[model samples]
Target: MDELFKGIADPLRREVLELLRKAPLNINQINDHFGHISRQAVSKHLQLLEDTGWIRIYQAGRERYGYLSKSAFYAFKDWVDAYLQWGAHSIDNDHGVFLDDTAYKKGMPLTQPVMLQALLSKDKTFDGVFYTAVKTTGIFCKPSCSANPRPDNVIFYDNKDDALKNGYRACKRCKP
Candidate 1:
């Protein structure tokens, strides 16, 4: 658990995890995502993530693939869920809802255009990061929501409250 926390502590490692969320990639592919960071640094981060069991690396012929252990995040999610329930009745301020600072610093860029593309592609990588609200239907949805809405009628919000505040209701399908 300590190593898991330590591995996820770095912004670069989190970014790597996000990339892996989409699909497994080789070291070279992962390195391509971070042009500013050297390959050596990326390798070290990948090693740490593997040690923590957040990712699994396998070799197929000469190329090595690093796959995100999707189940590994469930433990962390359960821990957070417990805390959220514990504080459910006591807390204000949107129940601790907030954007990840590391994501912003690392250029996750939840811009409208970027989000629209993710929505069109049904990108699961951005599922919990933002909600998309449709202007025409007045409903908000998760990024991976199957319901298709025109890009012109969509707006992205950082939290559910923001979507609600903007006159959008939660989408029944995605339950955003």
Candidate 2:
């Protein structure tokens, strides 16, 4: 609770948290959305949020990306559910338990490239990573990218450390 208040105490930090909730972003990307703010300032704000346990940072290639903390959201959900209970609703002849398509789109696989080499390999241990340097996206992969007759897009990585270091993401079709 102390950390949550610290995170929301500053308007700038609150906004940063909101922006990252939609998608992961590096410092530059976050700064680009606002005017009259130095990147250093934004970086400081991010650090505060990270320290407060309100956000998490991950390395994607040479750049660092910011994302909302799962703990924060889960806590918020618990508070909301405790205080207010909304009635069940339905849409399109189905219950409201349906998955939210928009929220689903923000996950990693939707934007990640599909790595083919990893998909073709016979080794089950090599399935999680895929990498390619020459491709337009620089790197690509799928969780189950261990097949054969590798597609033109693939260049597999032995592990996530290598794939991420090379700037690859888990593919959308078969998310890694």
* lDDT of each residue in 22-122, candidate 1, tens digit only: 99999899999999988999999999999998999999999999998866798788878766774343243242333332323334566655666567757
Estimate TM-scores for all models: 0.51, 0.45
Q: State model 1's lDDT.
A: 0.80
Model 2 lDDT on a 0 to 1 scale: 0.59
**CA lDDT, every model vs. true structure:** 0.80, 0.59
Instruction: Please give the distance, in angstroms, between residue 55's alpha carbon in candidate 2 and its true position after superposition.
Output: 1.3
Tell me the RMSD of model 2 versus the true structure: 20.4
Q: In terms of lDDT, which candidate is strongest?
A: 1
Error of 2 at 26 (Å): 1.5
